[model samples]
Target: MFQSIPWLESNSELWLQISIVGLGLGAIVLFAETLHRLTGNSSELARKVVHIGTGNVILVAWWLQIPAWVGISASIIASLIALLSYYIPILPGINSVGRKSLGTFFYAISIGVLVAWFWPLQQFHYAAVGILVMAWGDGLAGLIGQKFGQHPYEVWGMKKSWEGSLTMALVSYAVSCLILLSVQGNVWQTWLVPVAIAIVATALESVSKLGIDNLTVPLGSAALGYYLSQLLPLGS
Candidate 1:
């Protein structure tokens, strides 16, 4: 089965790179959130937009194989500066519209660009699947959960809903499988990988007791998909 997809043999580095990138992004989000709370400021939409947009641009530049430490250092510096600006309260005059939705969109874009850069040239199809799952699946889960979540489930002492989590998992897995099969030409195999990724993503999103879902879901799902693809003999 692996023989059918020769690309995987040469593209192992891509997966590793993506995993590293995802983890890095997650860490940055965690740090930013902590900083925001410490400063007594909500992690508003403007802040998120700057973080996501700048982060994506930096990751894309790195993906172009420009340099290693250059992009990483620049991202770190920029993030630190953004965090500091929150304390200083630089922008008091400008108000933006759809800050939350816009931030989420750019956040999703950052993840997508990272996947695009690190994954094997053709494995982009799989990455795209992961991206869409993170954006749409998580987005719908939040929207529905906020509006209609009545029954709450306490998992690890966190207030989450089985209803919302289940919704996120099902939608994410379905979308992921559809995209993967359609794009990777692997329509016959059991959907174990997609299911596993959905579960991981949902769990992470639900238990984001630390308010880091914006960062974790995308990277976690993508990494899960990448690893599962290896075990499933998918023709990446």
Candidate 2:
């Protein structure tokens, strides 16, 4: 039966659903970038918006009850669009955030890939927490580091600050705690898992180069969180 074929049936609704979310996200980026230019806020803030926006936008997939492939396809299409902006000078504000790298592409790929991998496992929370940490922990690290970094060190010669790294760890821990608590409820054992995930996530973020930390932080954290969730009594 063709029912097994994911695309044999009309996917127009799926396409439309993704398109609407796509447009919404694009508008958000453009608007945030304009504000960034007007206020002279560091590009990192706009970058955070994009990072957090991309991660959270998956909620639309959940909302519309779309299939996993629909969500993955949407991410790929959006990534391709953002990738084109690099050459065309559109989305310049988002482009201005990072050095020469395809972090944007990886960000898109990370979302979809992690979703596909974790969806079947019912461990999507790990993916969500991972992306959230990368968004908040890494995003805030850059912003705070740029503003208040005093004691600097070199990780893989990339020149980071103790302040930023510490921020990454703490914020990651806090975000992890909130996510786990909401999904798994307040249990004594729940606190221990995020601590481990935060540590591993921080280390991975520290070593990744060429802006690949955008991908590494989330996937690494997700993998660690997934394993820990399995081992720990995550829920009562």
Candidate 3:
């Protein structure tokens, strides 16, 4: 059911889902802000919390079967908010992570893109894969890499550690496999798709410039998984 508009009357769940989505995202930001305050304004950690938390909203959309337009609308709105935060303190703990990067903005855009691509097709699981990949994979990779990454290397003038790259690969594979397995069941495509997506996602994350990885990794992983699954026979 669609949400009712002015001069229109009918049953619609659109506004309900939108309210849930708004509350969900708002809670994430509130939690992140609280963390920032408690931890002496550790923007980086708080930002990661927001990163991981916001990405999980795809799950909510999937479970509720929210309409594509609503999801896309939310994403576009979030992207605008993220972009605006870059110049202002609108998202104090998020954009000002002491880094010159557009990862937050890119992340929001990727969500919108994935929802627009998959929701209408009723293949929202792929959207889940993409968002969770960015959420857990990239989020954990950054955290673990900074904390444990010892051997560092530079890619296109950006420094990264082997530890982080490995984390990204393994996490991407797991997230992909988990979501895909549920959608396609135990099958060859399930294994192969995640493996390929994982490899590509790691490579994308490694060469990320100005946070472009936020855009590339999830889109690439989800698209690759979709195409690869189409090629292989899936189980029921």
RMSD of each: 12.4, 4.8, 3.3
Prediction-by-prediction clash tally: 0, 0, 0
Best by TM-score: 3
Q: What does candidate 1 score in Cα RMSD to the true structure?
A: 12.4
> For every model shown, what is its TM-score relative to the native structure?
0.54, 0.84, 0.92
lDDT scores in order: 0.57, 0.77, 0.87
Candidate 2, 29-110: lDDT as tens digits: 8877887889887766777777766666655655565567766776788689768876876666677433576777778888
Q: Please give the lDDT score at residue 122 for candidate 1.
A: 42
The sequence of per-residue lDDT tens digits that candidate 3 reaches over residues 43-149 is 88998999899989899999999888887888888888887787778767777734689898899899999999998888899888888998999999999999999
Task: Show the colliding residue pairs in model 1.
Answer: none
**Residue 165's lDDT in candidate 1:** 82
Badly placed stretches (over 4 Å) of model 1 are 1-85, 88-113, 116-122
